[model samples]
Target: MYTLAVCAEMVFRDLPIEERARRLHDAGFQVEIWDWTRHDLAALERTGAVFSSMTGYIRGSLTDEDDAAELLRTAEESVKAAALLGCPRLNLHGTGLDGRGLPVDPVAGEATGPMWIAAHRTLGRVAELGESAGVVFTLENLNTAVDHPGVPFAKAADTLALVAAVNRPGLKMNLDLYHAQIGEGNLIELVRRAHGLGLIGEIQVADVPGRCEPGTGEIAYPAVARALADLGYDGTVAMEAWASGDDDLALDRFRTAFTV
Candidate 1:
């Protein structure tokens, strides 16, 4: 089944978290929580949304054994928490390239060699832990630093490389279109590559220039959506957009784009 998820950061800011989740469920969307700190698994159980792991706030990359162990513990807990909420996947961001929030040079930045190595090592442990907990761990590419300041792995190639390095079944790509539009020029080509590598697990979308609803921006969303459909991608095609101070208007725009 093709699934829909609303990034929690966009929808749950003003409302109670549970209420946000309930609304998503009512609107026919499965919820994907982002950078969420307040709600727990018990709360997720009450609401129908699936919980994906939020990263970047946790620490550095998942590549170091010691650091990986710590993340394993956290992932284990998140898995248990998500299980309570009946979620099947936990998503993460790669490590930050620089502490100063500069765009990472793909070839030389800390997030490149050692950091990438560390992420592989870290996620290897995460994969083992996640298997036992029944949670699938996925890593997503953020928009280039100009958009996701201080984050690492902005391009699709970097995320795919990290997944290949780990070579673990649990690790895969989150593949958000908003980020892809900013950094990648060819969506279909990249998606095809990810499929060939078995790296894509989840997908999301928003338009650029303002990260607003699909129809309101310049992205070729219809083509992108068609590409996703052609791939037989049945996972969540979440709308990761900002609300225009009017929740109904934002959701209406989302519904229109997705109704197909």
Candidate 2:
């Protein structure tokens, strides 16, 4: 079976981090965060909620040779923070080309083949660092069409390929269903393919169109949840979506839809 974890940053925007963790824990859910740098680790521990994962590093481009050192440095710091918060996994985004936040090649105006090579080498080193720290690194696929425009690893296939090229035990994929649905329609197939290859280490969910609770959009989250369970996926399925109504109701819908 799969457990549900809510993205505290997105769902509980107004509340303090400690209160957010408390409420989610009280409601029998785990919590995930974008960053653990500012949160009270002790208070979160007291809530008895699992810190599923946190973003590994932001702002640095994994595909840029010049930014490789900085990226690795930030990732090292993230591993330490994850250890402190009792989180075993870290999520990373392919920031931009050349660490300049330009998204695409400034001259070619699109992603080039050489970028992938640099990304593979840089991520391999970061994963090596994570392996010694007992932390796993997940490269998350974002939707360049909407949520994350210009992100290099927006496609599920590309992210999967990157992880495969790295071929590190500490490296894996953070498959976000919402982004996958937007960027590519074959959600279940992608999940099955990635799981079969043992590339998927973490999962996140949000319905398409509105990016809200499962039932609030076009994607059938219940079927997706069942597919995950059937595939023997035991990782946390984080609700990384916006709330449409009562937070409790939104979470209730998520729990009911993914109870398998």
Candidate 1: residue 119 lDDT (0-100)? 74
Q: Write the per-residue lDDT of candidate 1 for residues 175-222, one digit (tens) a residue.
A: 877788788768878877887777877877888768877777778777
Clashing pairs in 2: none
Local accuracy of candidate 2 as per-residue lDDT tens digits, 1-260: 77779998777668988788888888888888886666777777777777888878644676678776777888888887788778988988787333232454222334677888888899899889889999899998877777666777668888999998888989999999899999898999999999999998888999989889889999988888889988989878899988887888898998999987
Specify the highest-TM-score model's number. Answer: 2
* lDDT for each candidate structure: 0.68, 0.82
- Give TM per candidate: 0.85, 0.92
lDDT of 2: 0.82
Task: lDDT for model 1, please.
Answer: 0.68
Off by over 4 Å in 2: 96-109
